[model samples]
Target: MEEIFDDPTNEHRKQELGGKDPSPPELLKKIEQLKVELVQKEEKLLEIDLLYEHVSRLTDKIRTAAESGRHNTLLLAKRTNELQKKIKDRTQKMMALTAELSMRQALAIKLQQEMRDKEHFLMVVSSRMDQGLPLPQETESEWLKILRNEKIRSEAAEARARHAAEEAAATAAGGVCSAAQRRPAVYIPDSDYSLPLPRPYGALAPFKPPEPSSHMRHYRKPIIKPTEI
Candidate 1:
């Protein structure tokens, strides 16, 4: 057991001595590797700082562009509203004008139709006049002819009545007297009527008067005496 313990102690001392004793070239190489690793780490930290700054600048530019777009959009909306109002006003005015035109056209058509009706009526009247139609009256032409014949017969009756009246007046007067008082009554004959008896002139002669006085004989014309002057 004493020999085993002495062997372990010796082995431990040898390892310690070996670990403490290092080569100069090996230490120098290890220090150079450590410096290279430190430099690489510093370079990676700088790249990260630069990337963060680039991202911040891009975000600022995007925010500014969005603000400007909003302003432009508001202006476009205002202009579109104004244009819509103008379009509506013009459309209403056009509709009113169209309605007025339609009314005028209707009135013109009505007047034209009335004129056409009047012209047609005139044409029909003229055509009827050209057909030799008689004027309207209470009696027709044949009835008028009958009335005219009755009027002519009435005229003849009036003439006969007048003749009868004249004959009555003559009969109411004194009878016609003859020159001779002793002669028989004689009637003169008319060519168109029956004759009565005729009397001789001697039987119809009046009686002679006595001689006139000297004053009455002086008023009468003297008889011419055929003597030698």
Candidate 2:
């Protein structure tokens, strides 16, 4: 076991391979070589430190740029969301305004139609008055008062005409009726009707048939022809 542990070279040769008891010249040469290696190691350590410092500065710059990019992206996303919300609000407002405009337009059309109908009614009333037709039944209104006045004027004119006709008849039959104490009877002739008399002023306007809608036009009552018995 001792032999297995021991070196194969002699003590003198071992001294040249850095043994504890080395020769003076050998020791001096080894020391010089070690000193050279130490100097080289120091130079390598300085180069490594400089490389590490450069790498650290580059890493710091990259980290700062990444953080700035992240902040910018977050800001951009927030602005995009705000713009979307504003657009949504504007779209809703536009829709509401459009609906309101449509409703107002419909109301205006209805009001115009009512006004036209009222104007037409007034025209009919005036035409009826010009034609000596009785006015329609209505509440106590300005048109009703005008119609009453017209009726009174017409009755008064008819009364005057009757009185004139009676006077003419009496003058013609005066001699014949001289023996009779009673007044002479007068007769007036009319082609289409009896003598003109003051009729009661209780008549209404002439009836006007209503225009039928498309749906009701097809269901009208048919006229029956007269048949011989």
Candidate 3:
């Protein structure tokens, strides 16, 4: 039985050996071709490395360009800011000058108004004089008399006013005088209150108070009461 199994195995081995194709020379040729392909592949890898180096240099140039562009942009922004500041400053100065000009214009207008008022007053006076109206009693002689009277009256008035004002000032400044001491015994006449009356023909007559009516005039006739008789 062993010989029978061994016989089939030997026969199968013989058939496999007979059917197998010889491949040693083909494998050697394939190995030599693979070595050539590997050499070409190594050359391609070297070319790829050089391309990578060129790409790196190009990337660095791009980075430099980007940085330069950023710097230029920053410089432009700074210049814009400075220009804006200058414009703002100029605008403020213009506003200040405009305000000053407005103030000056207002002052000029006020002065013009004052001048117009003065001119109007003068014109009114001249027109009244031209209309043959009686002028105010301020003639040279009358004025001289008025001035002399005013000088005397003013001297007296100033003395009284000064005394009163000084007393008031002293009281207000914490003077030691009592109330009774503060007031002095003095008598003033009603006649002393008289002011110079203007003539009826004078220009200032229109401004004076109306004279008393005839019915309102005072008389010295005595009243006869029964008890007095």
Best by TM-score: 3
TM-score of 2: 0.36
Candidate 3 residue lDDT tens string, 116-150: 99798678768878998764655456769989999
Q: Weakest 10 consecutive residues, lDDT, candidate 2?
A: 175-184
Per-residue lDDT, model 1, residue 81, is 99
- Residue 126 error for model 1, in Å? 4.3
- Stretches of model 3 off by over 4 angstroms after superposition: 1-22, 134-229
- Across 118-221, the per-residue lDDT of candidate 2 in tens digits comes to 89988998899899988876723767799999999999999989867777787888733233345224333444766575343334433455667789767968
TM-score of each: 0.39, 0.36, 0.42
Clashing residue pairs in candidate 3 are none
| Candidate numbers sorted by TM-score from highest down | 3, 1, 2
Please write out the lDDT profile of model 1 over residues 42-154, one tens digit for every residue: 89888988988998899899899989989998999999999999999999999999999999999999999999997986676577679876533533566799999999999
List ranges where model 2 is wrong by over 4 Å.
1-58, 137-229
